[model samples]
Target chain A: MADQLTDDQLADLFAGLRADTVAAVLPPGADAARHTVRRRRQARAAVTGGLAVAAVAGVVGVAVAGTPAAPPAEPTGPLPTADRSALRDLAESVLPPDARSAAAWSFSLGDETSNTAGELPAGSYRMVVACAGDGGTDVLVRWTPRGEDNLFDPERAVVVATGETACAAAPSPATLRFVTPRDGEVMVSVEAVDGAAGRAGFAYRIVPAR
Target chain B: MALTTDLHPPPETTRAVPDFDELYAAHYADLTVQLFAYFGDRQEAQDVVQEAFCRALARWSSVSRYDDPVAWVRRVAWNLAVSRWRRARTALGFLRRQRVAEPQVDGPSPERVALVRALATLPGVQRRAMVLHYLADLTVAEIAQREGVAEGTVKSWLHRGRAALAVQLRPTGTEVSRG
Candidate 1:
């Protein structure tokens, strides 16, 4: 019969278990790893830039648009519910031909509390924003269609831009003319004039300009 | 106001800052492996580690200056993994209740699967203590400090964890001998 296992034996057993962990997944080479790091850095910058844009725009919008733009009326449409993968596809579908995603976050709006000032009334929308700080040249912003309701109503589904500079082109419902300001960030605000219950929100990121 | 400083300014010692490239090269694989063992899922491990590294790179100038940069990354990665686990559990639980088939997660060795299954039987605290102790090879005091617990408590946990693991790992012949 075997005697009680010693601490050394126990440690050896644990070490053996570690050995059984199979081959460690090799990293995607040093160059790929470095690229990942850079991409991540840019994504962080984009998020920070988005926040900065929102802060600056909040101040500018009050000074420029006046009256907090009166939060859009909550929509009364039949909101669409989508899994994260569907939302991601929606975000990707609207990107400019050359744009690539860097990061993404999903959110729910029309709830009791407001997560962002740039929300639509009560329908689900995904905000896909990207940066051009690294080497790229434009930030892409897309909102998933809130579905049949007042989600796409021109007056209700309005997009507003506020910051150092206004949208380069005439502002459309979703155009902040991110291509206009070469350096500074701008907030791209969306709102549904009318709203209903159960709205979803998503944030998708794209690689910043190199 | 009187001048408070003399002519000498603080010395400029250029600390070696490992840029994103260097840092990723040095730590990514090891971190992924450690986290894989921590969570028993390779994809989740990789995702969380990548997210943590991204956060580190975002704050590189400051994060790189930490006493233990790897520890900073590991801590963030572990926290991210735990948060992901909580969210997935809730979401997947709902799916399970509705009879929906959840997505499959691949890439765990048979031994790893067994180990995780065995570890799951222990209390969460004991499981954490054992993994950090045996897998990470952290000393009792280090575990205590990391866990915000007393060293005596850590020792007790380690003792109990070892006893539980021994029973779980006992050879099949041992059961027959007792029988």
Candidate 2:
């Protein structure tokens, strides 16, 4: 019985248990070393750069030409479903698959400048922006197929963030988009243009599904 | 003043890196054995210890700088084992009553069973103190610091714990030996 064991005996017993515990804990092959990190990096880069753009456009703002030479995306296309939810989900996904959002927040951003850019956090952020009649019913069109600033606005939208360590919000030539490159998180702002007093809005957070 | 956003390497990267392979070779056997003592269930203890270490790897930067990295990991592993024990305790409340009172049970090897039985008898803090003290080769002062108690308190625990263990194994006080 351990109760009857001397301190020396118990110590020896404890030492013996330590050895057995570690061996039993690390079953053979239950290590990350077995997994291929090289392949993972490649796959990550693919989705990070290319797929991220397509996903972001499909998810956040409407693509508009940014050549600074190109004209405004004619407030033409029916303002992306006055309930613009696709755009919100897209913004949130800009974060690397790990950010969540607070109930509400406010950010200072641009609207009709033909682009959205900002240095925001890096995480999964659920962003939703409403240009409700602000700036006389503006259009949230992601005009071009690719998301580029020089092709649209050389300004390269900049987003400076302050909050959770990693808040990912990828920026575009137009409205700021969340980008999840690192694992940190942060909150940011996207000013609504011509927004009637309270219309120009943007929200984000690191919210992951799994 | 403008905020300084200088990006420095994480603490783990900054702290001395351990030779994982060497650590594995040198201490693997001993660490495994000690962890097993914490939880008589060999398989579960192994899993927790391994996972805890992997986590340590993942956050090596933060954990390496800790006052005692190895001790830090042991503590993490210990916490995980405790949580697992709590869960098992709740779920197996009924089955425990019978086997617990008996001199023996029908699971695991005899050595493992005996060790666990003995561990179950010690107070939670004492068990932890004993484990860290013996397994990590930490002294009473270090244990006191880690456990957030005075050296005197640790001595008391060691005294009481050894006495109880002595009675359990060496009923006649002939000093039951383990090695």
Candidate 3:
């Protein structure tokens, strides 16, 4: 009987699906979207401009150069031991002062691991994943609700947010901000891009947005 | 600096870019619906669409100058959805080995679920072709241009995809069980 269904019938079915789905969605408003884009722009500008260097110097009491105009060259061999405290300081320098730490961890390239940050009420939070090496390495970071922590289980994990950042001489970091839909524990997972599992150390911290 | 130039193009060379607010207002719901039909997850679809808009806004100076800015936004949203889908598929495979069943959430109508399930069974390219053709009202040439394939390839995909959907949705077949 289905063989009798024509193209018009299939189109009608799709049209019905479209109407039902569109009616159920409530857009987060253009104003809210504009605000998000503005915030992201400011963050990227801060990172790439002199503001990041100034902030780091102010917080750490050391002069730091602006991020180089040219891309940092890739490391050929093993990287130096990651300075955890220094990386943390660099990460915190770019975030709001009131941001409270929820979880922090360190890992190497080619390793996929996750950290659970207990339960958090519906609110905004920031994730800072930093990589410290001579140069060229990137890490993928993902956030998912806790019980769904099977980093391998994509269907159920329902990733709330994700980002990627390259490693650099300084603790080059990729920062992502997201809001929890409801009160729930969340897990943050980090995986390095495929390559030699060089000791290019990485660190990530999750904190509540002020 | 190049960044400065990108942010503030010369007045003489600048074109009349569409208002961001108006663009968002006009296309947000439609784009979200298209993504929802593609992925079968309302929240995820909305998120990806919103993220795509955010990206467009960030690069508005460049994006707004495009011949069809909405196409840029749609492409970005589709790219994001595809990346997430790939990650999910990888995770689903691992979980399948562990015998962990994903929790099902109730929302869509029975008819919608049946169609979505049938669509899900098709290969990714074919399913995408079906949705883009039937739901988005895109012609074969348009889909071909967007997908960077020949129009004949798109026609074949649509033909095969429709035939498969018919078999899956047959009334007497066990494939689509009605509620």
Q: Is the docking of candidate 2 incorrect, acceptable, medium or high quality?
A: incorrect
RMSD of each: 18.5, 18.1, 15.1
lDDT of 3 by residue, B1-115 (tens): 0000111111323568789889998889889877877776677789999988876775454456666788778877986786666666665657543432344454567677678
Q: Residue A13 of candidate 3: its Cα lDDT?
A: 76
Candidate 1 regions with alpha-carbon error over 4 angstroms: A1-6, A29-210, B1-23, B93-109, B176-179
- Per-residue CA lDDT of model 3 for A129-149, tens digit only, reads 566542222222333454554
TM-score of chain A of 1: 0.25
- Residue-wise C-alpha lDDT for candidate 2, range B1-179, written one tens digit per residue: 01112111122335466654444445544555556655555555666666556545433433444544566556656655654565566676666565455553333445645666787688866766666677767799988877667999998887877777656655343654578
Better of 1 and 3 by TM-score: 3
Q: What's the true lDDT of residue A101 in model 2?
A: 36
**Per-residue lDDT over A109-177 for candidate 1, one digit per residue giving the tens place of the 0 to 100 score:** 222211222222322222333221111112213222334222222222222222211111111112122
Sorted on lDDT, best first, the list reads 3, 1, 2
Instruction: Write the residue-wise lDDT of candidate 1 on B35-135 in tens digits.
Output: 76556666677788877776555444445555566776777688667655654665665653343233334444454555565666777668778777887
The candidate that wins on lDDT is 3
| Candidate 1: CAPRI quality band | incorrect
